[model samples]
Target chain A: MSLASRELPSVAATMAPPRSPADTPAGAISGPSWLNNLRAMLAKELLLEWRNLSRLGSVALFGAVTLVLFSFVAPPQAGARRMATAGFLVLALLLSSTLSLSESFRKETHHRALTGLLLVPVAPSAIFIAKAFANFFQLVLLAPVLIPVALVLFSVDLTATSGVSYPLLQLLAVWALASAGLAAPGTLYAAMTSDLRGRDVVLPLLFFPLVVPVLLAAVKATALVLSGDAMGQLGSWNLLLLIFAVVHGTLGTVLFGYAVEES
Target chain B: MRGKFQWEHAVLLLALVLLTVGTYIGLAVAPPERHMGDVQRIMYVHVPTAWIAMLSLTVAFVAAIGSLWSGKHKWDAAVVGSTETGVVLTGLLLSQGMIWARATWGVWWDWDVRLTTSLVMFILFAGVLALRASVDSAERRASWSAVAIIVAYADVPLVYFCVRWWRSLHQVQSTPETVDAAMMLPLRINAFGMLFLATWFIVRRARLELAQRQVEETTLPERRSVEEVQHA
Candidate 1:
């Protein structure tokens, strides 16, 4: 909308500026081309994340260490073991998502780095989608590395008996949905907060609440899956995940443009 | 123009009087429910406070949208002020809910969907306010807080729907058909009265806050001049 220039044109005459020269890309901006753009943006986002290797490494290490510590505290019973597996899985997802999503817009805001990105031919929605995708991928990648350690520490069997296949998929779905929910608004707020004093504190303050629904759903669904409850229940969890993802994705896309412009 | 009371102020005062009378009527005059007993009286306050909480969040969302669309500091301030009021009202409602629960449900808390969602809403409100306080720059704080407000608020209905969609211990809505004539009058009156009170609070606080900021802006140059003279 900002790309449109006004000359007292009629409403019908007013049109948004095209990011791609092709008219086809204009419509595709909502579909596959956006997906491709999202993938590329995600790749760039991942590279940006990898640049902060120390932070990422510490977070992963902290997650593993936390699981190891929790194992000792949990009651040494079969039911407790069942509970521990879910708890550790949730712990890993929470650690990775919160840590990464909290910093989702860090690179963009540092030294007005985001302004340079905005000058590129990318759409604002694309930027959000890309950031969300990258964060989700990173959380996923970070999770598997902890899974084996968590299983050993929590005494979980990752076999067919574990029945984690459906749950794992469900958990992954929740994680991706939760990451998008967090990162979408988070990236925008981080950009705004980073420009203010004491960003060290403000970032988390802005992020935690915006993602509570995601956190609640993710925690519940993941816990259910890890507990290997009735398969029938997964349908409901998946529905919740779908609703969360769609709502966040739509809200994020529509509003990211405003945040970027204001930032 | 500035010295005289406006019609809006008169309306607010009338609403306050009505609220006081309504509370007296609710607590003193209304017949107690056979099931909930005297504790049911709390519904007059509890239900209204919960309504205000919901209203506050909605206003915050609207303010965020206004700020984003118009880029006004006043809109941002209203959003922040409404959010604070919402958080306080939510805390009150939660306490009242707990008291009512003890009298009615035997347990102080049940983790019911509605109650849990309300708790989550308060957490979101508190977090946003904390973020607003920690940031030093007015412009950056306003912009960022507005973004958070909008995003969080947009999820509110989803949360409500999610709770409603699930089977939970929390009782669903009590329709007009279900409610007796005695409870309906106070419920309706207090609901409107709370809206009036909430609007007055948000407007008055927003104006006072804006005036204070303007005072600071106007004084900055004078303060700078004093410092220069002292150095000289």
Candidate 2:
């Protein structure tokens, strides 16, 4: 992530003295480099996210609720239920992600704490990375709660699925990939919309269509894990998810400065 | 200078003439497809509209980068104009596709890969516009909307591939060589005509956007009463 410092120039970069150490992160000056700052910021983010277990509880509950509601929408026919279980599980995660992401930036806004952090000379890239990782971890944590509930509610037995040698492991990997993909771009949009009016509507509006690739790939991969991957197509779908995560992760890191510089 | 004959008028006239001629030839001159019959004629307008919409989005992506890189109002205006044009053209393209689908496929909608991606593309750009609408400050609006457009533009390829991989019922893309000789003229003419029309719309829309910014920046406070001013 420190590699981003060379190419990054924000409102702060223009206003700060050129002789300052922030611009040149090669550690020539004794000041903290981008990586150190990123570490500190990431630690701060994890600490905050860790302190909010109750919040995660509510979000998990929301996911479970969404899972239940989705089950009701499908007919009781065994074949159709089995076919749709993967979609239901992923959609629950997708919906619950909005709940968690929208709140991730709220803590930063109180008392203009975000402005205070920016004043402390934290690189926006660091802040973005920290927030994205924290969000990613939070969503991953949801897998423990939501996946089991989904399996039970949908009457799915991963062990009985075909093609894949390790269905449970594959499903976990799919969840993590989807979470990472959602977290990167989700963090960026969440930051933009956090303080805006009608943010609830705006965040999902901007996010859902943009992350269609993630949703599609995750659902397909999960379905394959749950049902069968006779054509050995699971690897390709997982690759799509990884690509989505990487592209947006890099983009969000580079663009965060512009989005949050004014604040 | 206020009422001068401008280049936009010339572009607009050319677009209209080309569109009229192209539509006529597309409807009357081009031979119907062997299977779909005259229903294939919808492709004449639909294909051009799709091409122009995609082009407009590419322009929007470029302008988005320029806006973020330079922090210039002109770039922001271009972003607005191009994205708006893209959205409108995509809407028209979808409608035309639906009409063609209804005639041939016996349904108005299906989960075809290209169709899904196009719909998602439409929504993504529309979301950018929605974000722009909600922001009150012009600078923040410009920056945020540019960010949104960049993100959305980057997602386009992924969206297309993901949808395609998930389920693909749509036909493969058609090239000029695959098309009949008689269909080529109308397609080429209409493609150029749509491109020109999109340019005309983008230019005019950008001008209006820049004007709006000027109005916002130049609005002065109400004139104070003479007595109150003298006392101060």
Please name the candidate that would achieve the greatest lDDT relative to the true structure.
Answer: 2
Tens digits of per-residue lDDT, candidate 2, B6-43, equal 79879999999999999999999888877667878888
Worst 10 residues of 1 chain B by lDDT: B168-177
- Give every collision pair in model 1: none
- Model 2: runs farther than 4 Å from truth? A1-32, B168-177, B220-232
**Each prediction's RMSD to truth:** 7.7, 6.4
Against the true structure, candidate 1 reaches a TM-score of 0.82
Candidate 1, residue B117: Cα displacement in angstroms equals 1.4
How well does candidate 2 reproduce the true complex, by DockQ?
Answer: 0.70
Give the runs in model 1 whose Cα sits over 4 Å from its true position.
Answer: A1-43, A49-55, A120-122, A160-178, B6-8, B161-177, B219-232
* TM-scores (chain A) of the candidates: 0.72, 0.88
- What interface RMSD does candidate 2 have? 1.1
Query: What is candidate 1's lDDT per residue for A18-61, written digit by digit as tens?
Result: 45676344324577556555655565666555555666677778
- The candidate that achieves the highest TM-score relative to the unseen native structure: 2
Judged by lDDT against the true structure, how good is candidate 1? 0.67
Angstrom error of the Cα, residue B165, model 1: value is 6.3
Q: What TM-score does candidate 2 reach?
A: 0.90
